[model samples]
Target: MGALLILAPFVPWGEFLSASIKNPGKYQRQKVVIDNKPEYKAAAGKVVNVNDLQTFPPNSNWVISYPSSGDSTLDAADADTFTKYELIRLPAELGGDMKDASAFVAFNKVCVHLWCSPNYNPAEGHKQYECPCHGSAYRLPDGLATAGPAAIQPPPTNAMPILILTADNDGALNIEPPVWEVNRNGVLGMGRALYQDGKVNVYKEAG
Candidate 1:
């Protein structure tokens, strides 16, 4: 039995292995649409104005949808997991102002550790993204893991996926379409790595 168990890995599972090897491209990495306009939509298909976000109490956050799937019937509140993001308005001490893109940040709600959803805690001196499932905590603004298991993980998995925001001439905030290759604007479920200069680096799968 021991020998059979040891040799099991060497044996191909017939058609499954053969089909996978025959069509290697069938499992290519997910492709995202990069040409989607940067528009922010709130629950019930309401268009969120960037200026309104600025007026929100400091440290407040709202769930928004980005990179529309072009389905007008789909409610923003019902957006797919990957398209949902938590938009945070920084506090005054964290460089939050009523204007400028720096006042806000958006992070993927999916926790990289175990795919549990994290929530924003606005308690004074405790503003952070906290995972209720495992107590993994991420610091505010940058989404860096500061406590719990996520903190001990290596790069790419140590940080939460963040979105890049830009302001239009009319003061509406838009989300720059995400590029999964380099983790720019961040890949939905995957975490991000940072360079020494604090810029997001290309994602490398963990070994």
Candidate 2:
């Protein structure tokens, strides 16, 4: 029938929607153990020191993995792709500071459109997280989708899940343990709504 053909396009979203409704807690934010030995070249795992320019330079990004299991060593290598996040240090001109959390931002690399991984393109004037699978692009610093199919999607899926960062006394960056709540820290793949002036406005689905 014509209705069935029209609804075929939305079939893919049903799985995500059903999972979100039936098991909302699965998408809730939760504390994760950062791997002491992250992949990609950083062996010390302390390579995120904000004060150390040599460790984490401005406009640079790193792919880090966090263990989903409470045990750090047990799940370090087998950590899920959703647990992996891209940490980016903004340039000084973009509010990056030596000892400020605002200077850095981290987001889950899983693309909300189809769960494909996205990579940060640091090219000048093209500093955006772009997904090769579907051409979805998320803007830096905020992780909001600006292009491709993801931009037309609704909230939560339209944005990438962000990780809250903090700077220690030594200027080493740390991830604030996330709680199981939306908009507070950030949901796993669903993401949270963006707001201005540190104010968060929660989004609710209509019945």
**Tens digit of per-residue lDDT, candidate 1, span 111-136:** 76666788788888788888886687
Q: Please provide, for model 2 over 59-174, each residue's C-alpha lDDT reduced to its tens digit, 9 standing for 90 to 100.
A: 77776664345454554565476678877777767766556667888888777766778888888887888989768889867888899777777665577777677667776666
TM-score of 1: 0.67
TM-score of each: 0.67, 0.70
lDDT (C-alpha, whole model) for all candidates: 0.59, 0.63
Clashes of each: 0, 0
lDDT of 1 at 23: 55
Index of the highest-TM-score prediction? 2
Best by lDDT: 2
